[model samples]
Target: MRVGPVGVLVRPRAGVAGLVVAVALLGVAGVAVFSGSLDIAPARVLAALAGDGTRVETLVVVDRRLARTLAAVLVGFALGCAGALTQSITRNPIASPDILGVTTGAGFFAVLLITHPALLPGGSAMLAAAAITGGLVTTGGILALSWRAGFDGLRLILVGISVNAIGMAGVSWLLLRTDIDQAAVAMRWLTGSLSGARMPDVLLLAPFVLAAGLACAYLARDLAALRLGRSVAPALGTAPGRTEALALLVAVVLASGATAVAGPVAFAAFVAPQAAMRLFGTAGPPPLAGGLTGALLILAADLTAQRLPAELPVGVVTAVVGAPFLLYLLHRHRRRTSV
Candidate 1:
């Protein structure tokens, strides 16, 4: 079945408006690079981009800088798409991998490998695989808990918050017990830097992301069915449990793959789909749209981060950027429900 979008019959211009978002993001990126935040001139940026530039520009701008930017975009897209799928499956507006402790779980495990030389394999690939395992296990735990209580949305969120607290404590314990050098390294990863993303890590993430994305796309119809509640969905030829599991699997893979590539970049998942849902009206989350929006968000944020005097980690910038939006969402939801 060729699953398409859920049409809520919004303004005729709404689709066009989505296209404009990409253009606006590009403008912001260009301004960031041109405003002397980065030493590379536009021509140099263009030249390095085109595979012909000075050695210095090629090394610093193209290899170091642009690679990190691209990593952010790819990771952000994965997280955003996964977030959309999870929210749809659970019918929860605040459902996100970060909030559910999945991302933090991955980070915790990966940090262990980075900290302890005696712990298993220590390569990026091994760390990534471990992270994926951690995320899957964390998600499985949440699902199990949610299932026990008949999968209530409010119950699931409460469980997720509790899990997040536990995961945070685990991360802190790792920080406190590890040696200083290892702690420093793990801390950078935790803060989520796009500082040194190489071609190999990017290549590793590509296939998993593509496969997970396609899986989410294929499940979109069943996802829409799920919003009607578990009992109602069965009458529509949908197996709610199975569909939710599949969506959760896709989300877990996406979240893990993204964390591996870019560490646990904050709020990419929560912010992307929420923004897309707002833009598209009262439709199911648009996987494609969410992915694009995520890419745009990360790209813009990374560009800004690079240009900033302090050059904060892209993830840090995203956290600062997304927190206010999250607060607004919380306030709005509270107000509407109270009314």
Candidate 2:
């Protein structure tokens, strides 16, 4: 399907797959909202959603679970889209915000601010601003280091890996400098928790998420062409450099906002787009499908984490699920290259 100047090739079953994934996401969200420690009945949850529930039920659903759930969904969607954009731009299957150090960079700044309040004087808004700045700086460094002749995917990935290590080390150093209680708090944030997420956090992040999403949708055709190659992209009237820069900006913003809100959520970004492509049977990342898949993944992981005897971070659950899949993907890629 051609939209405007770019062509979007959709598989026959893509729509159906998208619909199925959307329904699954809704179901998972419902389970997440209803199966918390409070254990609101599904019917009452629906009533609360519809503004027709008892005071306590309304508070549980509206004030507590709903905000957290929405935050999860928005963050997941942003990360998924960011992942898809990064993978497509780099033409690297393993490329994601987390792996590329964007999340780590953002997390580093946010943690720094949390541990040392003197850094940023403002509230959550300033913290988010710091995260965005950190992520963009990291991205800029990676691009500058890797751009010898042009943007080389292999070099970019290699540089990103190194940068991620450095960022993590910085985070570790900060954590070590803090006292036990402070370290514990920072550790939870680093591990990614949605425990006390409120409507304000969601509100803070929504604009960035929505804006990035719209920009990605608009650039979908260009992204598809760019994935073909530099030569082909130019022929298709897509400026490869500009498109890549814009795409990276979108990714950095999305990732930074999500990290600011939920800390670094492990491999949600890495897993979502890859899983979506397989499910949608697309040649490249399907942004919408990826977003839905991410939402479902996080919601499911959060629900599981919440239901555990001792509550675990959502990042821990996602890491547990995503690590094996990543290894499998690497093996498969190696096999294909060898062939």
Task: Assess every candidate by TM-score.
Answer: 0.88, 0.94
Q: State the C-alpha lDDT per candidate.
A: 0.79, 0.88
- Candidate 2 per-residue lDDT over residues 57-161, each given as its tens digit: 988898789998998998889888889989989898788999999999999988999888887699878878989988999999999988997888788889999
TM-score of model number 1: 0.88
| Residue runs of model 1 more than 4 Å from their true location after superposition | 1-14, 25-38, 41-44
RMSD of each: 3.2, 2.3
Judge candidate 2 at residue 140 and give its lDDT: 93
lDDT for model 1, on a 0 to 1 scale?
A: 0.79
Error of 2 at 108 (Å): 0.8
Which stretches in model 2 have alpha-carbon errors above 4 Å? 1-10, 52-55
